[model samples]
Target: MAKKKVILFIVEGPTDETSLSTVLNRIFSSSTVKFQVVHGDILTRDFTSTSKIITAVWDLVKGFMGNIYHKNDICRIVHLTDTDGVFVPDKAIIEDKTIRNNAHPYYTETQIRTPKPDSIRERNRRKRNNMGKLQSCRHIAGIPYSMYYFSLNLEHVLHGKTNLSDWDKVHCAEAFDLKYGDDPNGFIIFMQKSSFSVCNDYCASWDFIKVGLNSLNRFSNFGIELPAVSQTR
Candidate 1:
C-alpha cells in the first residue's frame, strides 16, 4: 500500500490548534492520514509588529518550500489565524477581503524585516500600512497551503459568539463541556446565538473547510463535513 500523505496545519495557538485538529480528525476518521500542527504566531500588538510576523512565517515555510516543491508526498497545508484586531467591527484595522484574498501564488514576497522609521509614530504608521498588505499572510505563495483568518477571534469563531469578554469565553467553555460534550458541530451551534459577526465567521469557516474537505473526500483524504453556510446560520 502507498504511504498516506501528511497534511500540515499552522494555527495561532494551541487551543485553536487543538480545535482544528479535532475537526480534521473527525473529518478523516476512516483514513490513516497524519497531521502536524505548528504553533503559528499572531502578529497583533502582543506578538510584536508585522515585520516579526512576516519573518516568522517566512522562516517556517522556506523550510517547507524546499521539500514541497521537490517532493510528491506532502499533500497540502492550511493556515489558521484569529483576526485579533482585523475583524473587530467596532475597531477593525484590516478589511475582510484583504485577509481572505491574501492567499494566492502570484504575489511577490517583500523584504520587511529591515529597520523602520525612527519615530514611534512613523513606525506605527508603517506597521499599520504593511499589515494591511499581508497581515503577513505570506502562505499564499505556497502552492496548496491556503491562508485563512478567523473573524474577530478564535473562541468567538469556534464558539460562534462575539464581543466575548474573557469571562464569557471561560463560561462558554464550561457550557460547551456541559451541553455539547466536546462535539465540534454542537459547539458550532453554540456560535449561532452569538453576535452577527460570529454568524458570518461560521459561514466563512464552513466554506473553507467544505472546499478543503471536498478535496479530502474526493481523494479519500477528509469530512464529516458541516452544513452549508446558509443552513449553518
Candidate 2:
C-alpha cells in the first residue's frame, strides 16, 4: 500500500488544533492531517521579520519534519493565522492607560485600546508587512504552501467573540469540535455559508481583508481551501 501524504497545518496555538483537527482529518481522510503549534503569532514574533519570514517558515517546517518524515512525504502546507487588526490604520489604535498591562490589548471593530499604543502601532506595521510577504509566498522548501487568516482572531471568527480568556478559548474549541467532529461536511458547509467567509477567489479574498477596518472585523478565507462537495452529499 502507498503511504498517505501529509497535509501539515501550521497554527499559532493548541486551541486552533483542538478546534479544527478532527474535522480536517475527516475531510482529508485520504491523507494524514497534522498540526504544528508555534505557541504565538510567528509573523509578530521577536525573532521574525518581513525579510526573514520565508526562511522562518522553512525552519518551522524543517523542525516539524525532523527525523520522521521526508520532504516528499508532505502534500502541502497550510498556515493559519489571526489578523489581529494588523492592517488597520494607526489612528485606529487608542491609548488607554487603564488597560493596566501590555499583555492584553483590547480589540473592537473600530479601534484597538491598549496601554502601549505605540507598541501596538509598531507591531501592526511589522505584522502587516509580514502578512503581505507571506500572502505572496507560494511555496516553502519545495512544498506547496498557502496562508489563511481569521480576523480579528480565530475566536472572533469561530465563536463570534474576541479577547477570550484561556479557559473560554478551551471551552469554545471543545464546543466547536463537538459540533463538527462527526460531520466534517457540515463544517465545510457552515464555512461556505458563513458571513465572514470570503469569496472563493484566493487573491480576491486577501484583497478584501486589507481594505478599511475589515481586518478588525470578522473575516476568513479558510473556506476557499475546503474541498467542494455536492449539495446532495
Candidate 1: pairs in clash? 27-223, 160-191
- Which 10-residue span in candidate 2 carries the lowest summed lDDT? 224-233
> What are the per-residue Cα lDDT tens digits for candidate 1 across 93-156?
2223332323211111111111121222233344344345453243443535445545434654
Instruction: After the best TM-score superposition of candidate 1, give how far the Cα of residue 213 lies from its true spot, in angstroms.
Output: 31
Structure candidate 2, residue pairs in collision: none
Candidate no. 2 TM-score: 0.97
